[model samples]
Target: LIYIYDLPADYNARLLQYKHHALACTWRGFDAGNHTYLKDSVYAVETFFHEALAVSSHRTFDPEEADFFFAPTYLTCYMWPVHGWADGPWYHAPIPNPRPMHAANFIDEVGRWVNATMPYWSRRGGRDHIFLWPHDEGACYMPSWIYNNAIFLTHWGRLDADHVSGSGWPPDNYSQPVVYPRFQPLDWRRMYKGHLCYTPGKDALIPAFKASNSYHRSPLVGVPPVKKDVLLYFRGDIGMYREWWYSRGIRQSLYRLAMEDKWREKYN
Candidate 1:
């Protein structure tokens, strides 16, 4: 059974109060309503996950009955910015987004709070705790003291993870997801590579969050009744138009190979 720690709103809800997150979505054509206010933001998955389990039959109120403790911290939204580049509308808005603390510092804050305010983390030293890390590179930057022992629910899993990308567009007013200096060579980053971003069998890798409304089939958009024949399916970073040897070049290989019509009949 899963038990969600009753962390204070400052950890989760307060982060959502940052209007820039909603702005990141609404400006991208993702209209929001109801509890789906954060729906279309790429990092908004934890909101959906936490909301579902909170009301679902799987959540246990008693900590003793819980197999895994879910720390419902919204790290992704905390890290995501209005834009990665300076041209973002919010950059010059009259009322701009309030700066959030650095992600590393936030992680430390959450870790310290749970350790002191509750007994669960101390019991097993956080081995049974589950952290929600919906960042682009997952919990790559999480401190070793916390992540080394706990479980991470993340969106990315890379064995050779090198977070060369900036979490937000390189520092404007908002500070988060620390970026490597513009001139930091690949070797320097590799030297400072973090601990166990995702250790396959040990950690859980979740999908990019999608809102439930997207799954609802409407009568107005009824599908034609017919037998479907399409077979092979794949989703994720298919490196199109030079994504810089992305997916470790696996997606690149597939992108090229999948173009051959010769395998259509045989593979299907």
Candidate 2:
């Protein structure tokens, strides 16, 4: 049902070379290892999703016989910050992460390449095409004029994520504007085309990566609805990216207030 395009390595396969660069850049993401079957890391979705489609029964080798065409590209791996376990992430707290610009340029280069070299993209203006854009802000990072016309499988589904005021600047999640050569847009109000992360009916949401063996540890991983036992089920870290002023400053205050003897049972 799907035809996978043979894109150059730079945009797709070459990005996988990062897996050896850092622990966080592993094939399982967050360095979870390769033997795990039940992977839970949401960041590895791009690899697993693409791998599934590549070997799935639904994939068609001949473009003419395909219902959908998939052009593989890994946007997050390019923007993923290079960090070590010692001093920490490459970017200092005061200095904002600057990888988004690089990622945007790579995207722009891909757009131009497809427009110039690929013949299939012009077919019905790519209505039957599909892309895997697993960025923090998701589809907002892709150009609407090219890939946007097709289906986008992304993690973030916000249509209005601007990474406002450089807030989500961990090098991976912020918004960066790109200036195109010879390409003009009618609307400039938004940095990227369509001015949104997701369009209601057109785009679809894909889950983050989960290695197959990862499910072995969790016995509660099933369809049956278990009893709701506790509240506040958060998985990610909740703290400041900077010491000066973390946006979630109110959380610390709320935690302290809740711990008080007078307010244990209520007001979360």
Q: Find the candidate with the highest TM-score and give its number.
A: 2
Q: Model 2, 221-261: lDDT tens per residue?
A: 76465455444433344443433223335445544555664
Sliding window of 10 residues with minimal summed lDDT for model 1: 91-100
* Alpha-carbon deviation at 129 in model 2, angstroms: 1.5
Position 174, candidate 2: lDDT: 41
Deviation of model 1 at 54, angstroms: 0.6
TM-scores for every candidate against the unseen true structure: 0.66, 0.67
Give one digit per residue, the lDDT tens place, for model 1 in 111-208: 88899988998899899998887765566666677878899888768665444432332332222322334432222222224676787776898877
Error of 2 at 82 (Å): 6.5
**What are the runs in model 2 whose C-alpha is more than 4 Å off?**
18-22, 26-41, 81-97, 161-166, 170-194, 217-225, 229-235, 240-268
In angstroms, the error of model 1 at 55 is: 0.7
